[model samples]
Target: MTAITLGHLRDALHAGCASAVARVLDAYEVEVDFVDADADELPGMLDNGEIDLLVSAWLPRDAGFVQHGMRLIGLLYRPVYVWASTKPLGPIDTLTSEQVGRFITVSQDAPRLKAALATLPNLAGTPVETCDEEVLYERVSAAAEAGEALVAMIAQPHALFHTDMLHVLEDAQERLGGEMEARMMVRETVAACADSDMLDELSEMTLGNKVMSALDYTIQVEGVDPEDAAEAWQRGRLVPR
Candidate 1:
């Protein structure tokens, strides 16, 4: 069996997506070993051939990570950053003064959200409270239960999108960084040695936003192991090739 090293960021979502790719590689009799590292380090590892493939790369935002010899072999999905609320919100510019005051986001997303807000003159002065992921979920859940309005900047394909009460607000202007494509990147050596058919299949594979969100919910909310969740999805949803 041919062996390959697959690299990914250390997060449940990334782990689950990587597992799905591993499952696909298994069909080609490829043995996959997973290597988890921070976003900053993974690109250099790929450049050094320490890893054969990266399960995903968020383009434009992480475009700086693309090294000289890296090849993007697949686009897994395109997920957009959204402003979600317990109730429907008017357009970004039309947001009520009260809505603008109630904006919140996770600490990790604060910088991006702030940058987006800065582009909207109407919302430049809006206060955005930052909290940890757990606290953000807790506050959103509480607001949903109380039928109160709370606006938040959340990236899609997230477990939070599983909440039935949460609605993505209209952003026709796409001020919130637009769609980010999650793509698979391979080292030049790996692409040269890999089976062409398997590589083509990988390039054609598509897991849209809905399926990605369900994968996230399964691993993050339902507490399923990423490998198990991926296997179930692979068996149930993915077409046999």
Candidate 2:
């Protein structure tokens, strides 16, 4: 079979995911070439057939990027932004004023989450502290160790989710706009090829929230290289042999 070019965003999580996909293709004795690009450029590359497959593209928000002749072939994972706390907060709406005041988030997510919090009358005017990713992780770890009441806005498939310290609060009203799915995309010609059965297998594969979180933790927290981490996971968990 000819070499298939795979593309992924330039992030640790995406890199790990792409590596895992490559391992799967390797098992099938397929030659794989990788293309790592920024999220903004990846879709265009796929549309132009510069890459045969894209490891992922977030739906709805990224839907505009799926130009003509490109198809989203698989649902890889559903990632959601969630409020997690060391305490059992029940749900987002049920948080006490103090808990709301204790809210914290990484800088990149602060604006979006703050806007979401403002939508609720009860949460309006609440202050959400912001910090860098590293500091946020440290804060959560420290809070968990001290058994303090602290709430943090975090996305699933993140390294922090690998721990059991945080209790995820239910967003009963869906205020967070946390509905997003990461899906595999392919050029139309590739999707129509005789070897497209592999795409079918990939489409049916689902690496639930926990596994993806563990994968991220391996790379981010445990200091494992993305490629090595993916190879370890693919061999140990996804396709043990």
Candidate 3:
């Protein structure tokens, strides 16, 4: 048990993880540090000990953090990059990779999408692969019109359309267990806390709490789950989201 500081992106994912930590470590009087790092810089903060752990939100896309002081505690959600297309894919259950594959661009969302696409026995093709997120969206937008080459992009805006022109070929999140996961970033500094015993006690207190929605938490050792306790804390304590 160590001081669990979180360097986060200020998203639901980050909030969710923080609350879970709070629930487990309340009695130890463990401090919850919130390091406000830009979404892109979160990994850096962990490496720098700016935060104790990144228990809230998505894991990194790159392997740069290998063997760092950080250790993954658990996953909260499956990250997703769904394909919403310009045309309606009728009876989607029968989709083939060739018919809809090209429309589903690949990037970091590949792992989740791959599992979802498996259900569509007929969906297969050379899905346009982009080197980065920006280009992936660009390609999807360009194909907005029929014979228009673009299929769909990673951004939510790509899914928004004036009419039925764009339809979700598949919900990446739904298909991927809400398409999100959480990992804790146990800082080297936090691990060396003078009060390590306090941390361990707190960790035991907050085990198996499902505090994943509405971004809130409450710490209680009075026989309540951590997530629900967190919800209470959010409602009664934390500032507005």
Candidate 4:
């Protein structure tokens, strides 16, 4: 292949991992191009040969895509999901639906989160509003500023950034599921790359909590460009010194 095309969601964690991938490939003298894509769009792009690799979280429901010839190369992170609020909500185990105002979540994650909420005793009957991530955050921030107790389901990394603006519902795992494994997915046509000895060198790579926090701090909080953040992460964290 002239170059390996990698696709990922436009999120901080993947942004860091994309950097890591680029640096690894660079060491191998292979060119790489990173493409930002929606979670739903990744399957189509992989199947249609528009991209070779994808770095994103895959829900259990997404196993069908694997049966359709997609391959899981390796996991990059296992992010804990949490329920964040603007006001004190007490323990997650003791919280009830009445305490939650509007449940804001990302549009891409509505289906999964909605299903989880349906089964959660603490969140039963709580209304859910799915919107673009930026809009979701804005709405949550506004609701909190107004003294409305709002809860949002968010990944641990992104939630950490909002600590000053939101209160994380500790022990949310009591009501939610386990950590989501963010991983690299490749088209079967390129599955051989996953098995190549060259893959081993990069396979051990992972975007841990600390690495993600730094990326978010630099890229989102400090306003660094995603590409530059990736480069710094690749060299400073991923590459052996």
Candidate 5:
């Protein structure tokens, strides 16, 4: 039996996809191992043939991995970023560029923030403080409590976890007219060595719609385990190749 190695960022979104992919491979009687990897390390690992596949979030066009000789097989989801505040953010349209620029915080290399800045060129020079994901919510919430008119641009699913303390800017994506997507990638060598038919079936099942639905159900629905949700989705929606 061939042992296939898979890697993904350690997050709820990627975890769901990893689960679904694992189940799909199981049907083909393939041995699979899962690795939780940091985003920065994925490119290097893939380049060195450390993993057969990497399930990663969609990146900007000029992202390093795009030129790293990896093949993007399919999209996992189209994720948006929200400008969340601890206090109410008034009508997005009415807010002046300067008013919206009090301060904006984001994670390192966040595609949503990149898009937002591109849309609001006036905010290009606005203060952008970077923070690790674990403390991102706390930093934004603290800024709000300090009476600072600030917003944190964060991934949509992560915003849900901070809903108790933050009010998501309702039309942030509408204003930006762009959203980041998640995609599954594999090295060229891995792609050539693997089963193309199975890959195609997995890719078809890995569309943004199916993965996002699975994510929402696992993350928002009551009492559902992520692994179980992914397994159920695979059994119900996927046609074996």
Candidate 6:
């Protein structure tokens, strides 16, 4: 078993993939070190050759990390930014200024911030009460766990990884438009490791991490026809493949 120290923000699909991989290849000794892995931090780690691989797996969140000298494995997870509420939802699309009990909180990512604002009603100007990607997930998770006013913003692919804690109030895929993509990066140092048996297992284990799909979900709502995706929305669920 090889040792790899993965650097990614918590609540990312990478963490979820690690959990899945644990079942198959515990001998691989996968250990996840949760760092902020901010835009600046990722490049620094790769520059200094500090980490084995940077497996956030969501391309759009930090494209600067993709500058030359790194290679990417196939798309591992969908880059998602989504939110959910614990209690019953109000008519969000029609939410008036008076109904703006809460505002959409988001990460500093330009695409995520823009997508969240464009989806609902009553939002004007820029994002309010900002947090990074991981914090946004935690806050949204807390809101759903404690049954608070469920309002948040996250990458759509990353959001799918946390199906237990959150649901889609709105999908950024539709909002972000066609150009948005889902992918992950492995530093040049780890590129050699990518083709080994370890990476083959890693790829199989991480195949559909919700963070890299074009539009994939896995909530497993009983009796909700997979074919009738729109009907799933009426029941507060979405198409789960």
- Higher-ranked by lDDT: 2 or 5: 2
In angstroms, the error of model 2 at 102 is: 3.4
TM-score of candidate 1 against the unseen true structure: 0.89
Candidate lDDT scores, in order, read 0.80, 0.76, 0.49, 0.69, 0.64, 0.48
Cα deviation at 172, candidate 5, in Å, is 8.2
lDDT measured at residue 225 in model 5 versus the true structure, 0 to 100: 58
Residue 45 lDDT in model 1? 85
* Candidate 6 wrongly placed segments (more than 4 Å): 1-5, 10-36, 86-92, 106-121, 125-128, 131-150, 156-167, 170-173, 176-184, 188-190, 193-195, 207-241
lDDT of 2 by residue, 58-78 (tens): 777577667788777677788
Error of 6 at 171 (Å): 6.0
lDDT of 6 by residue, 157-178 (tens): 5443436654446443455433
Tens-digit lDDT string for candidate 4 (1-241): 4478877777765676677677777777777888887667766776777877776545553453453666676777667767788887786667787888778878877876777676667667778888876455567768878999888877666624534777877774545666666666667776665446547755667777666766765665566877787787666752233
Number of the candidate with higher lDDT, 5 or 6:
5
Cα lDDT tens digits for candidate 1, 119-184: 777665666688976466678777788877778898787777765868888888898877899998
- Global CA lDDT computed for model 5: 0.64
Error of 4 at 30 (Å): 1.1
Those runs of model 5 whose alpha carbons end farther than 4 Å from true positions after fitting are 67-69, 85-88, 91-93, 96-106, 109-131, 135-150, 159-177, 207-229, 232-241
In model 4, which regions exceed 4 Å deviation? 11-13, 57-61, 67-69, 119-127, 142-148, 159-164, 170-175, 188-197, 220-222, 235-241
Worst 10 residues of 1 by lDDT: 232-241
Which numbered prediction scores highest in lDDT against the true structure?
1
Worst 10 residues of 2 by lDDT: 232-241
Over the stretch 40-158, how does candidate 3's per-residue lDDT look in tens digits? 67666656567766654443543444346765554444444455666666444655555554645446566656666566556555464544433443455556644543345342322
Q: Residue 14 error for model 6, in Å?
A: 4.1
TM-score of each: 0.89, 0.83, 0.46, 0.77, 0.65, 0.57
Identify the superior model by TM-score, candidate 3 or candidate 6.
6
Q: Report the Cα RMSD per candidate.
A: 2.7, 3.0, 10.0, 3.8, 5.8, 9.3
Please report the candidate that would top TM-score against the real structure.
1
Native-to-model Cα distance after best TM-score fit, residue 210 in candidate 2, in Å: 1.5
